[model samples]
Target: MMDRPVGVIGAGRVGTALGLALVRAGYELVGVNARSEASRQRAADVLPGTPLRDVPTLAKSAGILLLSVTDDAIGSVAAELADGGLLQPGQIVLHVSGACGLAVLAPATEAGAVPLAVHPAMTFPGLPTDADNLAGLAYAVTTRPHDRPLAEELVRDVGGVPVWIADEDRTLYHAALVLGANNLITLLAAAMEALMAAGVPDPGFVLAPLVRASMENALRHGDQALTGPVRRADVGTIEAHLRALRDRAPHLLPAYLDFGLNTARRSRRAALNEAGRLDEVIALLEARSAEARDDIDR
Candidate 1:
């Protein structure tokens, strides 16, 4: 199957990057199907010399079809190909949706195509260099037991390490990734916004080392790495923060309180010695949250 020609549908950031990686890995990219102008441009830029074809043509010409459409569009696209009799028997059909499993490609399976879910656990910024990030990344793959080897090989060809995920566990696996990666970005953005509001210049520069060290410590020590007023159970400091946020960054008050409450709970769980004071901190956060809600109502 490594020698089979590959075709990509919905040549967006991830699709184009993976296609480029496969092409570099010696797979013949027969064609691509990209609907929007931006996607078409991305495919042209990243997978230059690859022919742009329609869905039916791309599906028929390639021995392996990569359905890189949005999570919601995967099933519908697979059904369309199956309905049009575009998928051939023994052909490999895979999607790059972390949230979906082989079930989304049931239509292709019914058409005698092998279905696999191959999701790389990395973000793609749609740049030409996005393919470089694939190396050493973990790919969460879910497929039939018989197709496991094929899925692993495909992932390795794109420079990814295959991590077998159960079909039933795909949603939870993807949820964890979103919670870690996406929510981290949201948290950083909110923190930077608060810094700017406080008249700080070069917020990223100021936070870079601290954020890096905190992430490293958290990854290495888990909850034991937690610090700050929440961990210390400093109710006075927490109150001061709430007042400052309310005065200068009212929009951040709710998030600050919510995260503070969670941090206090985690600290309580981690340190029995701090549990008593942490309970007070939690109560303080909850009360502030309620007050913030009341202010919003007014």
Candidate 2:
């Protein structure tokens, strides 16, 4: 009736971070396995008293094994343990891959272990500390029926809110997260570059609050909070921006147009509840995009 000892495979940032977290959360650190001396050193530095072993050695004895290996390495590692005759029935096998679902752990399942993929929806900046990142984070827990509740409980044990994801939606869900997190950072960097090129005064100083406020307002009101030329669909201003961005950050032109079109679509939806010239506004944007295409073909 007691929880099994937790074993962590792969001494990467996520593995090491979660291992230390589990230690504080009262789970016994059974052991960790990694191929590199640096990896072992990292594990020892952060998680003292934890033994270092290879996959079979860790899987043979540890009741719960956390596979924090890279996605490509995941199947091979699990298969190695299965082929080596090291795994046993009913052991908790967990992997931290976001794109892969429970299927990636088929080797572990073949070895009679119950497989779970618990993906933490947060980035590890490879900093010395990742404990704070674990707090208030959401984890997607996917497992076989017999193993799902245990997976959820284990995620809860580590102070993560567990969300169930359909197997088919795993890739799409991760895609959406990447678009929101990574793409946001990419857009911000591009924005800064463009501002500096424009000779904007204290470009960073000017952009910091403006960008933050736009995001903050969007969070509060969703699409209803949209403003600026796109929301108003000011053909003149948008056309001017298109020209300037093409002259400055030509790479961002497509993104600007795509996101602008999406924003206009949202604004059009918002216009349904209020009295605004959203219809005419969209028509003008359509005209501009068409004209830009025609100019390009010329």
Candidate number of the best TM-score: 1
lDDT (Cα, tens digit) per residue for candidate 2, span 1-298: 0268888898877778877877778888878887788888778777877888767677766888888788898888788878888888988888888888877788889879898888889887645477667867899878877677887777787789999988788888889889878999988887877888888857779888998898899779788777788776577888799889878877667667767777777877767323256555566657756766776789
Native-structure RMSD, model 1: 1.1
The TM-scores of all predictions, comma-separated, are 0.97, 0.85
lDDT of 1 by residue, 127-152 (tens): 88999999899999999999988998
CA shift of 65, model 1, Å: 0.4
The per-model lDDT (C-alpha) reads 0.89, 0.79
**Candidate 1, position 211, lDDT:** 97
Score residue 79 of candidate 2 by CA lDDT. Answer: 87
Q: Which stretches of candidate 2 lie over 4 Å from their true place?
A: 36-49, 200-204, 269-298
